[model samples]
Target chain A: MQSEFAVELRDVVKQFVTPEGNLLNAVDHVTMQIKNGEFFSMLGSSGCGKTTSLRMIAGFEWPTEGEVYIEGKPMGHTPPFQRKVNTVFQNYALFQHMTVYQNVAFGLEMEGADKNEIEKRVKRALEMVQLTGMERRKPRQLSGGQQQRVAVARALVKLPDVLLLDEPLGALDLKLRKEMQLELKALQQELGITFIYVTHDQEEALTMSDRIAVMSKGKVMQMGTPVEIYERPANRFVADFIGESNFLEGKIKSVSADEASVFVPALNAELSGVPMSKDFVNGEEVVISIRPEKIRIVDADAEKDGVFRAKVINSIYIGSDTHVFLDCNGVRLKVMEQNHISRLDPHSFYHKDQAVGVYLIPENTLVLKKEA
Target chain B: MLQRLRENKAWQGTLLALPTTLWLFVLLVIPLFLTLVVSFGRRSPDGGVIYGFSFHNYLRLIGYSTNCPAGQSACFDPLYAQILWRSLTLAFWTTVIVILLAYPLAYFIARSHPRRRNTFLMLVLVPLWTNFVIRVYAWMMLLREQGVINGVLGWIAAQFGLPFQPLQMLYTPGAVLVGMVYEFLPFMILPIFTSLEKIELPLYEAAADLGANPFRTFLRVTLPLSMPGVVAGTILVFIPVMGTFIVSDLLGGKQVILVGNLIQNQFLSARDPTFGSAASLILMIMTLIVTYFYTRKFGFGEEIITA
Candidate 1:
């Protein structure tokens, strides 16, 4: 029977011995399931166990506690060569001595494929990466981007079930990295193979991944779609990591099916219709996460239920939006407004220390669990 | 003035090269020119130079002889030809054996942990701290018929109440080869170790992830990448083994004569400076020819050193 999941990690743990003679868990009990043909990403900073998790899936490392399943088969201490998966390294580890053709054909040659079949597959692989007619060049002779393409082509030529990428675009410049991001996403869709990417860049993960697992200190913080992760984060750590959030510490007063009323001490008022991540008990401590774009500036004298008076400290007018920094009582909050009107009028922008009325939309406000 | 001097790159280059240029001219160029001039001139009766040009020395070196046997007008002596061929063969074997032994040892040291690798490298270099001749004498103590090796075997035989005779191991071609390999083994190991250590760990992972077994990864990735070191080690071991006479003199006794022995005999024992100069010129030309071909096929291994 064919399994629905392409890869599964069941409570996997990896422990390492530190130089100071202490045992440390590099991968702490991470369990995740990546669907077939899905683009799954592990997002975290360095030493956050993202790369270690990818290595376990590729069989370069075996879990210390649980098991890793590839295509529903238990992968227990299997060597990398025996596994049907490939990895695109962070450094684009192309063979320096071999020509592009030879490097791309290496896997086929190891399998003892016929000469004609190897040539056909290698040419097609190079063409897919847009490296045609450059087969005679060694890796050192090519530019960094071209070498990275060769690495991708070398891994893709094998046509494995899952492809693991460990920050493959880390070495490229910003413009090129952005371009390759789109190209990689397109390639994944065209080939319809499962991709397990590891990276610390939040924007790259948000733009390309079908589902993302935010990891910190060897533990999975949260896993969800980009919209869910950005709009309604599971906890304070997820809210703070995925994007900028102004947190207002509060206590739950009442809860319904989808919304809850939280009494925020900083604002000295009760916030109603706040989206609840999970059911909360009465008087439990929580944090209300409000995105900068969700707040709007109204007339200072307007009478609104959720409106508060604040003094603008600074305003920065970028091309598409204007960032207004304000201080309400003792708490500082940032408000982002789109530059939809008054492009050339300097009078329309908020000045320093100018009094303004801040309105918070309860629909966009999220109630998260307070982190210790 | 300082700014102008700094701006002039040509002047800076010339000033930097001045000392080494003068040193090479005085120490190397003049001696080589003198050797070339003496190779073409004639030898006087009392082992003195005669200022006259002739092709007699070159012709005699290729086997033409003036001192023919009593029945013949002219004869061909194959002594110098045989000695040159023997020296080439000995150098070739010594280089091959050294590479076989050094590559594995170098790999072991390069793959070892960082703290222990230093200790292993120091052990490889420890033998070089003693004098070269003294170390060769140490080998003599081990290889001699009545020395340590034979003495151990003889004692073992006496314990069993059996008649035993010591094997003849010293003063043979085999002993000379052992001495040459022992002296040049480090030269082979160091360069190979440098190249092997410079390889990034990710390349091995890439190879394995692309469906290559451990042995295939070594052949396809490790061996091809470390070739520059092998080339450098061969050059260092071969050139010195070609011109060394002391090892042969001590180990080969009078059985195996090489081109170095022939040249030494010409200058010291035979008192023929002209023939010795001719032999020296031939040895230099042959070494240059072999080195040229070898480097043209493989690189000069400069990348291995700099990398």
Candidate 2:
């Protein structure tokens, strides 16, 4: 039976020896399975081992422990040329000495394909990236965005089972990067080839990935869809990393199948029906995370079970939303309000030090385990 | 006045180039112009240049000679032409051999670890600390019949009870070629190493990812990218090898007579300043022609240094 995964990393670990005589685990024992034709992303900041993990998959580095497999066959020290995979490097890595057509045709030429066939595939690949007329230009003559497209075309022309990208658009400006993100996602869908993209950009990852593996400190924190990862983060790190969250320390008061009651001493109130990431015992310490947009500033007389008094310290009007900074009994919190009304009314803005009642919607709040 | 001059970029450029311009006019331009003039003038009875101008020296340099016996026309002499051709061939071979030897050593040094790479580069440059003539003389010592190589071979042969004869390696074309290659090898290595080291590590990975094996990667990626260095090193070695006479004089002895020896003999031994001036002008013209065609094909070697 054929394996469902196009690429699989089974407990891969890579260690590097530092100049100071210390052994460092650049990539710890990490396992991941990328489904066939799925756009999988590994996301983290610099030095978080995300690139190291991708390199292991590309056979640039061998794992000190465990193994990598492609198409259900173990890749035991297989050199990169023998592997049926291609990479779009961060720097675009186009051959500077060659024209765009030659760069795109290098792979087919190496495979000993007929000259006409190579030329036809190279033409089609360049056309796919919309670089048809610019075939004779050198890489140094192309702009950054154009060079990135050339790199993508060069890798895709090989028609490998999997394609790896290491921050392919990290050099572009914001507007071009956003446009390319959408275009790359569309291209992946059109080609039906599995893509393993590595990037530190959370927005780019969330925008294009079918599933993302959030990494920190050489370990995968969580792996799920964008909605599942952002809404129900597994731990304090995941919640804090994926999006902005105001964490309040608390102790578990009651537990159930899908909800928990947390008694937050800072807010001097008990939050009931809070969504739980895991079942916790009563009297166990935890942190309750609430997105700023989820917590609303309601009228003082509203009848809510989880309503608490807060004093607004500052209010920032940020075009689309107003960020209201509040102090609730020595615990600082941020609440975001969308500007739904028109004409910039003075009555819509909250004054400084105005006492208000904040409502914490039970289902929107998440309870996570405390990090050491 | 200084502020006004600074405001005008043309004036600023002229002022900055003033010293070098004057220096070139005094040392290089004036000497070359004098050589050209002397080449056209006739030689006096006491080997001094006379005021009359003619094409006698030029015609004589290209095989026409004036020492015909009384009624016949001027005869053809192939001595100087043969010397010039010999010099060209020797320089060409020296450049080719040096490139073959230096390219691999440069690759080794460039790919070595950073700490060891520095040591290797220093080793390549260490011999240059000595004078050029001294280095050539050292080669003479090794290649002589009674030299260190023959001495070691003699010892080995005596131990095995074989016939021991000192081979004649000195005063031959091979000796001169060996000396030229040894002396000019560093010029080739340094530039090639610079270009090779400037290549980023990711390009190799990208090539392999594109299905190129290691040998194919070197042929397509490494070799093409390092052409600027090869061109620069070739020019640096070929030009010097063409004009240098010390290595031939010390190693080739009387067997190898190049154009450099011809020019030296005319000026010093034969006291024919006019003939020497003609030879010098011809050498300059030949060098310029070759350099022009070379640069047209491969460009100025500026890219290797900048890269």
Task: Give the CA lDDT, 0 to 100, for residue B241 in model 2.
Answer: 85
Model 1 lDDT at residue B49: 74
lDDT of 1 by residue, A69-141 (tens): 9999999999999888999999988888788998899988888899999999999999999999999998999
Candidate 1 lDDT, tens digit per residue, B210-249?
9999998988888888988999999999998999888888
Q: Rate residue A251 of model 1 by lDDT.
A: 97
Worst 10 residues of 1 chain A by lDDT: A340-349
Clashes of 1: 0
Root mean square deviation (Cα) for candidate 1: 2.5
- Per-candidate Cα lDDT values, in order, are 0.90, 0.90
i-RMSD per candidate, Å: 4.3, 4.2
Residues A187-210 of candidate 2 have per-residue lDDT tens digits of 999999999999999999999999
What's the TM for model 1?
0.96
